[model samples]
Structure formats: C-alpha cells, structure tokens
Target chain A: MSKNLVGNHIRKLRFNHNEMTQQQLADKVGVTRQTIVALEKGNYSPSLELAFRIAHAFHLPLEEVFFYGDDPTQ
Target chain B: MTYQEKKSIVSLISAILIFGFYCLYMYPQYPGGGLESPEAFRFWGSFVLILTVVSIVAHIVISIIFNIVFRMTTREKEPNFADELDKLIDLKAFRNSFFVFVVGFLLAMGSLIIYQPLHVMFMILIISGFISDVTGSATKLYHYRRGV
Candidate 1:
C-alpha cells in the first residue's frame, strides 16, 4: 500500500482556475477560509462530506482531491 | 490559528503565570509548618485573597480575548468530535495528560506516607494536575504548529 497520503495541489488548481481564492472556494464549500487554507496546506484532512463539496466545487473526482493512509496522528 | 488552538494557548499561558507566581513568591514566603504563626497567617490569608482576585480577573481577561479572537466562552464546551482527525488529536492529548496525572498521584501518595501532612499532598496533586494539562496542550500545540 502507498504511504504517501499527502494529496492535492489546490493552490495550483486555484491559479489555473482564474486565480480563484481560498475564501471563494471555502464559501462554496460552507467552511471558513482558514479551513480551506489548512486543507490546501495538507495540515487538515476534510470529512468525506467536505471532500465531496470540495471535489464538486472543482468539478473533479474525489480521487483527484484526497487520498487515504494510516492515521498521521498515530 | 483555529479556535481550539487559540483557547489552548490562552489556557496554557494563564496556567503558567499562575504557577509561576506560586513558585516564585508564595512558596518561599509560606511558613514551614501548617501552624498559625503571624507571618504564616498573613501570607496565607493574602494568598487566598490573591488567588480569588487573580482567578476572577484572569477569567475576565481571557474570556474577552478569546471571545473576540476565537469566539469562545469562559467554560468552553467539550469539543464536538466532528471528525476523525479531531478525535485522534483529542485522544493523544488525553492519554498523555492522564499518564502525567497518574505519576503525580503516585508521588503525592508516597510523600503523604512520609510527611504525614495532607496539605503537602494536596498541593502536590494540584500542581500535578495543572502541569499535566499544560504539558498536554503544549504537545498538541507543537503538533498543530508542525502541520499535523
């Protein structure tokens, strides 16, 4: 199994999508901008529901956004 | 920082200050035994009064700062275990603090047997609890800062 649970180049994607800001995406996803920043920075992993919202916002598949691995906190 | 992070930092700092005052000033001035010497009575009475006043003032200051910055209350509610990550963090911190508390409790028990003084044992227990909580949060803060 893969150990690299790290995922996403959300900042890159945002830039590709016309300089879309973190606040804009967070508003669409019903979370605060700090949460979006945390997600983008890989400091936080979103809930499945939040993951779906993020993927939906980007018009992409969930696989393109996040990946699973052993609990990092463990 | 998230609300939890802000609240944790505030509580840790407040505890450090409280403990700092106790160790630096109160302990040295405290009388040797639990007897009612004039110095002991004066210091103990003032300590009680200062503790009450400091606690009330600290709560007000921390409450206002936390509310403004993090939208938290004085007696903050237990965090809603909203996600797996949060639960994991909580568990790690809780376990660490519990271990610390147990060690402190054992030491206090041993000292109680030797000194035969309930007051000394109680002080040890109280200090132990505070130290445990502060260290637990400090660990969590380290993880949070390291982008866990």
Candidate 2:
C-alpha cells in the first residue's frame, strides 16, 4: 500500500516557539503528547479539526503548519 | 504511555491469564459432559461468578497501582480525557477487532452445524467474546506504541 504523504512543520514550529516541548504543545492543543509525536513522525494523519487545532496551538495559518505532498522525505 | 494504553495492557493480560486458567480448569471436567449435567452446570455457574469478581477486582487494583506509579515517576497527573486522536485510534482498533469476532462467530456457527452440542456452542460464544475483547485491547495498545 502507498504511504500517506501528509506533512507538517510542527517540530520546527515547536523549536521556533521558544523550544516548546511536545507535552507543552499537546497541553495547548488538548491532546496527548503521543498524538503530537505521531504527527511529528508522520505516522498518522490528523482529522481536519485536529489539524486546525494544532495550527491554532502554534498561532499559524493551517497551510503553514500542514500540507499534502508526495515526498514526505522533503 | 497514556492512561488508556496502560489500562489496555492490563486488561489484555488479565483476559489472557483468566481465560487460560478457565480453560485449564474446565478441560478435565469437559469430556463426555454435557451442559445439562448438574456437575457441569454448577461448575460453570460458579466459574462465571468467580471470573466476574476476579476480573473486576484485578482491573481496579491494577488501575490504581498504575496510576500511582505513573504519577510518582512522571509527576504528571493522569489525563482523564480521550482526545480526538485517541477516539479515532479506538475506532480503528475496534474495526480491526470486529473482524476477529466475525471470524470467531463463523467458526462457532460451523461448529454448531457439525457438533450440535449446546454446551460446546455456549463455550465457543463466551471464548469468542473474550478473544474479541483481547484483540481490541491489544490492537489499541499496539497503535498507542507504534503510532496511529
């Protein structure tokens, strides 16, 4: 099966936001740290609501936080 | 690990151990015995009662102990909420477990057609239900560890 290719800048955003920890971001977004870790690892694709929530946690536009592409390696 | 993941692990272990013990206890008594037999009926009746009590007690104790240990080690209070991702993982795990139950049900039906033993059918149903629950809990734990 083809792997899903949703991508995110969460790790970078966290770094930029004064070295925010995964747990901190999770608390901000009302999710478990594991969910944030999964998103960072690209092992799961979030629902639209979660996607918006993550973006809101970082105070960024949705596109700036997440995007769809074929090359997740990038 | 999350609280739900820890709970699932405990539940899966408990189910396997309890069911294994039940099978061992019943095996010697099951040969040539039908459900209508007073001895078999009484054994099953008491077994069900004991299993119910044991399962409830074990779950409560394990949950409390794990919660205490987790809080002590992590200094983070246990999260009581199931977030959107956790709910989605639960749904996915349930979908995977539903197929296991369907297969078990089909096998039980086939056994009913072939053997036609009421006691055997009942045992199959009970075991199948437990297997489904174990599968669901295991799948949830796996997803929690491996990501979902």
Output the worst ten-in-a-row residue range by lDDT, candidate 2 chain B: B26-35
Docking class of 1: acceptable
Structural similarity to truth (TM-score) of each candidate: 0.64, 0.82
Query: Residue B90 of model 1: what lDDT?
Result: 67
Question: DockQ values for all predictions?
Answer: 0.24, 0.51
Q: CA shift at B74, candidate 2, in angstroms?
A: 2.7
Candidate 1 lDDT: 0.68
lDDT of 1 at B43: 67
C-alpha lDDT score of every prediction, in listed order: 0.68, 0.80
Error of model 2, residue A50, in angstroms: 1.7
CA shift of B9, model 1, Å = 3.8
TM-score of chain B of 1: 0.60
